[model samples]
Target: MIDSDILCDLILANKHKCKGGEVADYIPGLKNANRESFGVCLIDSNREVHCAGDYEEKFTIQSISKPLVLMLAILDNGEDFVFSKIGMEPTGDAFNSIQKLETSNLRKPFNPMINAGAIAVSSMISGASAEEKFNRVLDFIRKISENPTLDYDEEIYLGEKETGNRNRSMAYFMKNDGVIEGDVEEALDVYFRQCSIRVSAQDLARIGLFLANNGVTSSGERVVSEHTTRIVKSLMVTCGMYDGSGEFAVRVGIPAKSGVGGGILSLVPGRMGIGVYGPALDPKGNSIGGYAILEDLSKILSLSIF
Candidate 1:
């Protein structure tokens, strides 16, 4: 087990940084989050959990759901089919930017971590109805995290649907370019619902540990193939932090995905998984306090993959 004292010190060290950052204001429900909240949970390969502060506080998964959805899309389809629709490279633009979609010669989003690419991938999930498709993704998240009660936040889902004009614009653009097929609204629903799924820092750590184990659950069940996990983790390393991914890699040097809800899911191959939540965000949307905690944790623990 990781020392609780270290985790506590990390929280105290970075708590003041929350004052310098802003909570996500665009999402009406997200704006209600407590800006001073900060927490971290770490799970090792041995299934040991180390946590501090408000680690049990539940929040929407947000963009951190992208990597998991991409995994399911690949499992349902194949790499060729999925990558044919979404490029693997990172975009320097914002996660919701439409400029790249209009400019790309291939007419595909730069990567699955972006809103456009995630919507394209959500369209590819196999199911007769949107509900079936969403349940499939939700079940996958539950199994991997060992959290049977995991569910989406209705308020968060409504907020996303109400203020998701920008996302709708991206989906419509992709549909017009033939990058996504059949019922664009259905695809957007799946994407929005996935983002609205509620999880605590501990839940995120459990999911991260699943990735660290190459898609295997704590009980030794393989939820996804090793090949699929590799692709998802690669995307997390390259595109997970929006435009701030490169800097995160340089500083923390781990495979991590951050959500607008102020959560970061990170993993060290064959070692441990970490989750941090700090609602106050920098201009680029990453949690300022959460980022500081991870940076210090990585240095102190020598957790960098490099």
Candidate 2:
């Protein structure tokens, strides 16, 4: 792990990037975030932890939840069923863009990291009811993070539900195309709730550590299969940063997922898991200060897998 003093200095060095960025305003509940807020947590393969800034501040998981839900969906329905509805290729369009869905010959979303594909994947989680389905997703997250009290923010969930016109359009479109099989609202509900789940940067780091450890808990219990972890990390590399994934790879060179809420869940496979939060975002919805911090840390530690 990086030295604590060095970690703190890294955060202070990049904290100024927040001034040039914007907090996500499309979602009403996320608009009030402190624009200057920044934090990071890193947990290495030895179970050592290091943190700086406001690492314990809670925020919604947002799109960062996509890969986690994809894991559960795959566990419930075989990879054949899940991937049949969602393609593995990366998209060049914005994460929420609807253009490619119409252009693709199969009508499937380009990949699970985007909203359209995540919605499709969310519908595949098995349960007797919508509530049961959401509980299962929540349970999976809690188990993986080893945090039993994990929960979502109702205000964020309701706000997302109310303002999610674009997402609704995608869901209805997928429903019409048979990409989604059940009630559209039910599927959207699960997606919304998952996105609204709240966690601190430390919590996100712990989740990333779980992935870094190949889905095995610190106690040696396996929460996800090795094959599934590999697929998830690959997807993170290719699609996790929305259309910015390629640029992020060239710059930071780690598998990561970013949410519009300004949280990033990243891992250096077998080495460490990193969680970053900086509510100020660039045009692409990634945390500006957080990105700077990661880039600096990657260069300093030579953490890039490439």
Best by lDDT: 2
The 10-residue segment of model 2 with minimum total lDDT is 1-10
lDDT of 1 at 67: 94
TM-score of candidate 1 against the unseen true structure? 0.98
lDDT of 1 by residue, 49-78 (tens): 899999999999999999999999999999
All candidates' TM-scores? 0.98, 0.99
RMSD to the hidden true structure, all candidates = 0.9, 0.7
lDDT of 1 at 170: 93
Model 2, runs deviating above 4 Å = none
Whole-model lDDT per candidate: 0.92, 0.93
